[model samples]
Target: MVLQILFIAIALAGVALFSYNLKKVIRNIRIGKAANRTDQPQKRMMTMVKVALGQTKMFFRPIPAFLHLIVYAGFVIINIEVLEIMIDGIFGTHRVFGGMGALYNFLIASFEILALGVWLGCAIFLIRRNIIKLKRFSGVEMKGWPKSDANYILITEILLMTAFLVMNAADAKLQAMGAAHYTTVGSFPVSQFLMNLLPNTEGALIAIERGCWWFHIVGIFGFLNYLPYSKHFHIMFAFPNTYFSNLEPKGEFSNMQSVTNEVKAMLDPSFTPPEAEAGKFGAKDVNDLTWVNLMNAYTCTECGRCTSVCPANITGKLLSPRKIMMDTRDRLEEVGKNIDKTGNGFDDGKSLIDSYISREEIWACTSCNACTQACPINIDPLAIITELRRYAVMEESQAPASINAMLGNIENNGAPWKYSPADRLNWAKES
Candidate 1:
């Protein structure tokens, strides 16, 4: 009865989670729209697949990357055991892989070792985030965030994974003590050692074994249900986000509608045209943003690599690349929910430059492309900043005086520095 109940519970939970994730996938696809790309479709797909499955981005930090590689590899390989357990729950039989007992034992030992490595990695990450207190790790000026939420999610994942390992060890010990000696004696040395310490009574061993199994199963299910609402949501979001990353000419900017055509009729001969409504110039809400930009927000892992590389953040500028992504995501979720409830979308009249992000924060960016180059998931922060700049200067006429002066000089003298046009040939002369 206990086994039967466990089977039913696992099946129901798995179905529910699969259904929920499917709906989210469909919704994101509909929202993503159609993007024109300059890169060959096949090349872009290959790059995305390599990065997503290969853990390419985590390698920015070698120690963390190595540890994560072990854990990731183990997670992928050890899922066979999970499938076997699910099968056993459905059928009365326990072991599903009858032919490869030796291989199964070897895999179990490998996963156990990897689980230990993962624990160490989690410890290092926790220490870095909490004790080291590096500026880059802070992400942004926003006080509560990533520091708190990120820590919570990381700790929970570590705990859950640790529980899985403990439960396995206990189950192995129980099996070795019982009359059913299914496993090869020499292959499972750790279980053999553990069996020496445990009681021989069937009822007592069975109770303990059942308790551990329940913990393992419940831990997995709880982790799944909590995922979407937690910082760890990125685990699920990252896959699809990577799959749909922008695959275009990195040097080129997205084209905007011709401003002349849209506003020519609105112009009055006697009066200057009032600034076009705000949301028209830059993204003020989720719907206003390109689908790729939205996916960038979802994909960010808050790993602080971008924040570490950001020149502005390095120089004590208020910008944190990670925070920029987080803030955009937060604002999008907030505005999306409001729009959903009220059926009234963005304010539509306010420029993103003046309302959403400050001019100082925007202009402080040096276009060094460090953030873009550093992002693990191919998020192009520099591109977004440049697009916003284009809107501000060309559409809104809200650029700083220095920028206007530079433009004027370029127009009058054919150079931004007001150098003589004749001097252009001087560089070619021997100097």
Candidate 2:
């Protein structure tokens, strides 16, 4: 009963802390302008299923994708055993679902296998990051906390899986010994090998089993709380992020409704424009971007897959789509902290543009959708980049000379080129 109470308290506290952090993330995301991602419910569901759940886009790099899928599948499937653990912890019962008989055995067996797979996958991933030094994992944005965060998650997962297997092995030994309260329920196909390492004494085996059990559950709670602060938050956010994915063609850019209304009014004098809204022409900060844009920032995996495929980055340009998302997220976090310190409408003289993201970086983008297509969960770093560019051009009149000349030509000649409509036909004459 004492242990049960302790478990309940620990679980409740863990859940409460996680909820608090999750609320902060949601509030930060809501700081951005409203976007209509709620539309196309059916299509969104399909996208979530195909991309986030199925991990269809990850297969672009088969080896890493396969390893990642193993870890991903293991994470989802092994959590079923956590349910049983929770039940046992709360009720002070042994193997609470053992009554399910063959079904329970099958579940435990599968979980054991998956746990091993997760361990192996995470181990390989660690090697790939630290030893092999994969290019995608070594971007400028991935330095410091981002790099440490990835390592922390992988190591923690490895430890948790190890504890799980050890716990099972000890439990199996206990069952064989006909120990009290240690039911002969689970099938330890993978953990069975670990049984040889455990002590032959019953008391020592129980101690090891109980210790591992506590460690595993506590580690899970710790991992859950750690996620919001880590890039691995993608694990949870991927589903919703993919669901709210921009369904438009990759090359298509979103137009500001305010600008659209103004254009319509100018083109058709009879067209009544809505009441003028007081806001910046384009995104100057996190608040100026759409909620989906902010969500995309928080959802970035920092895998650098976007950066790897970027033509701009490939050609030695300052623009890294991955860095754009990272900067947005960093800026959003800074803004969130400022708001927490002051009130809701606080400003610290720092904005995403020219603060976290540089003008050179913004202008370096070729406007290609390579990054968007390369993302496994469909995170659109390009969307954030374009918003910053819009802010620079419209609000600050800070576009590059080439872009300024092109825009001037379009405004004056009704085309991107300086040639008049009549003169356009002269090119055909010359041909």
Candidate 3:
């Protein structure tokens, strides 16, 4: 009765959490608009298959990637065992892959080996994140996050996997002590070896087996409940996030619409345009951004891949690509409530250029597209930076003086270098 209730509760919780997240994802997809690009259907489908199904991005870093693959594959394959356990717990009988019983045993053995691989992989990841402290692996430096979150998650995953192995081991021992189960004979070796060491007592071995089963089930369910709130939330979100990632021209900026001009034109066409408003354009709040931009903020795994590849960051500029995502997410969270209450989400008077992202940071971008290229989830930081640049130069006239001089030269001299137009043909003739 206890087992039945526990199984039902866990099953319900899993379904509820998955359903809520799935609904949010669907809502985002319906609302999120990507600019129509050529051959989009093929591109989108291929990207979905390659990145989402193939686990391509995780492979960019070999050790972590390999470990992740093991864990991912194990999680998928071992789910059969989980279902069997649930059914047995409820019905008091094993109802699983009955035909090709030998193959089923082989599958179980494979997952057992894979479980150990996952534990080892997670251990290596923990060491790299905490002790080794590589700059590339340093995710967003949240101010108040407990230092123990990563450690705790890693330890829990390892313990859970170990419990699974121990459960099998305990079962193998029971089988050797005169149990006639086919799964016990061929599905586990470590447990079988350990069982030989135990006394031939059915009651004692059965008790041990039951304890391990409970431990394994409890650990797995506990981890599942904790997943959404943790950094490991990416484990579930990443696949969908990758599938729905924005694929657009990385070099271009989104067109910004000006409200001041529209308002003034509506009020009085004869009134002269405001000088201060001439060049003011950029996103001042979440609603001002495109839905895709908003989705980008939520999809960020805080993996620091963008930060690592940022030329601005490498050259000692104040901008961290990771921080751009973090800041956007933070501000969205802050202003979202206000937007919800009042339905006023636009920039009343604040300029995003001066207020949120500084001029120095905006100008520091080289437009090298390295950040975009390095991103695993197709986040185009270069494009975001360029959009801000467009707002600064065209809308606000707040660009560096050098840019104005260059533009002037382009206008009057027909060259950005301030060279005479007559000299353009001279170089060609000489060459």
Candidate 4:
């Protein structure tokens, strides 16, 4: 009973910390400009189910996909056992759910298999990131904390699974000896192999079991706290992010309402344009982008899949869609932190355009949408790129001479060519 009470206190404290961090994250996300994603509820919900839950986009690379699926399944499914652990901890009970007989055995067996799968998946991911040294894993953006973050998750997951297996192994050994309170409860087909390494004594087995139990649960709580500081927060944010993803056609761009209104009045000579509020053109800073854009920032897995498929990156251009997303998130976080520190209303002088993302990098994009398609979580870095381009062209009129010429031609000749519409047929002859 004393141990049970102590466990409850620690668990509640962990829960409190997690909730506080989660609230701060939500506050940061809300700092972004408003965007309405409330339409098409059924469609959005279906997308969340299929894309986030089903992981439909992950299968684009079969090997990583399969391995990721195993880890994802283990992470999700093993939490069911955590619920039982919580029950046992609170009630001072041993094998509380063991009363279910065959069902309990099946559950235990399945958990053992999943725990094994989790370890296997983590091992391979570690090898790929460190040993084989996959190119995507080693880039300018993945230096320092990013690389360490990946390694930390992989190592911690492996250790947690090992702890679980060790506990099961000791428990199985205890059961074999008919030890009191240890109970012949769990079926440990996988951990049974570890039995020979463990002592047959009752006291030693109990100590082993308790130590592993404490480590596993405490580690889980620590991981929960670690997530808000890491890209691994996507494990929780992906669902809502996918649900709120922009459903516009991939090829379509969202024209600003201000631009649309101006064009309408220009087309109709006598039409009266509404009194506009004089909004700033395009995305000069994090505040200029929509809340969904900010949500995309939070949802980024930093997986480098977007960068891997980028034609610009492949062709040796300065642009990397993955980097674009990271920079946006980083800048947004900086702005948010500034706001928190100064207790002011969004007065950060550093904009995302020149401070974080460069003009050359934004302009290098072909707008191919490959990055958007390749993203497993539906992150559209292309959208952020386009908005930044809009800022350069409209807000600052900073487009290149060649682009300026094209824009002038369109305004004057209704096409990219310098010639008038009447001379359009002369192109073939001139060539």
lDDT of each: 0.64, 0.91, 0.65, 0.89
Q: What's the TM-score of every candidate structure?
A: 0.81, 0.97, 0.76, 0.96
Off by over 4 Å in 3: 21-39, 57-60, 89-95, 98-100, 139-149, 178-186, 190-222, 225-227, 244-249, 252-281, 335-359, 391-397, 404-431
Model 2 C-alpha lDDT per residue in residues 1-431, reported as the tens digit of each score: 99999999999999999999999999999998888888889999999999999999999999999999999999998888899899999999988999999998999999999999999999999999999998888877888998999999999999999999999999999999999988899788999999999999999999999999999999999999998898989999999999999999998888788999999999999999999788987788889988999899889989888999999999888889999999988988888888888875346777788888999998888888899999998999888888888888988899989999999999999889888867877866885
Q: For each candidate, C-alpha RMSD in Å?
A: 5.2, 1.4, 5.8, 1.8
Badly placed stretches (over 4 Å) of model 1 are: 1-11, 14-18, 21-34, 141-145, 179-204, 237-240, 246-249, 257-281, 345-356, 411-413, 418-431
Candidate 4 lDDT over 113-158, as tens digits, reads: 9999999999999999999999988677899888999999999999
Task: For residue 43, give model 1's deviation from the true position in Å.
Answer: 0.8
Kindly report which residue pairs in candidate 3 clash with one another.
169-191, 279-395, 279-396, 280-395
| TM-score, predicted candidate 3 vs. hidden true structure | 0.76
* Candidate 1 structure quality by residue, lDDT tens digits, 1-431: 67777667777986798678646534443353345543576776777677777778778778768876776676666566667667756775555664576777776676666656666677777887789876656644435755677787668657755665655555666555653633422144333444556566766665655565566566666667766545566666666566666665566566654455355645755545445543455543445566777667766767778878888988889776676676656655555545567755455454334555666777888877778777767776665566567667766777899899999999899899878998889878957
Choose the strongest candidate by TM-score. 2
Which residue pairs clash within candidate 4?
none
* Superposition-based RMSD of candidate 2 using all C-alpha atoms, in angstroms: 1.4
Measured on C-alpha atoms, candidate 1 has an lDDT of: 0.64
User: Roughly what TM-score does model 1 have, to 2 decimal places?
Assistant: 0.81
Worst 10 residues of 3 by lDDT: 28-37
For candidate 2, what is the TM-score? Answer: 0.97
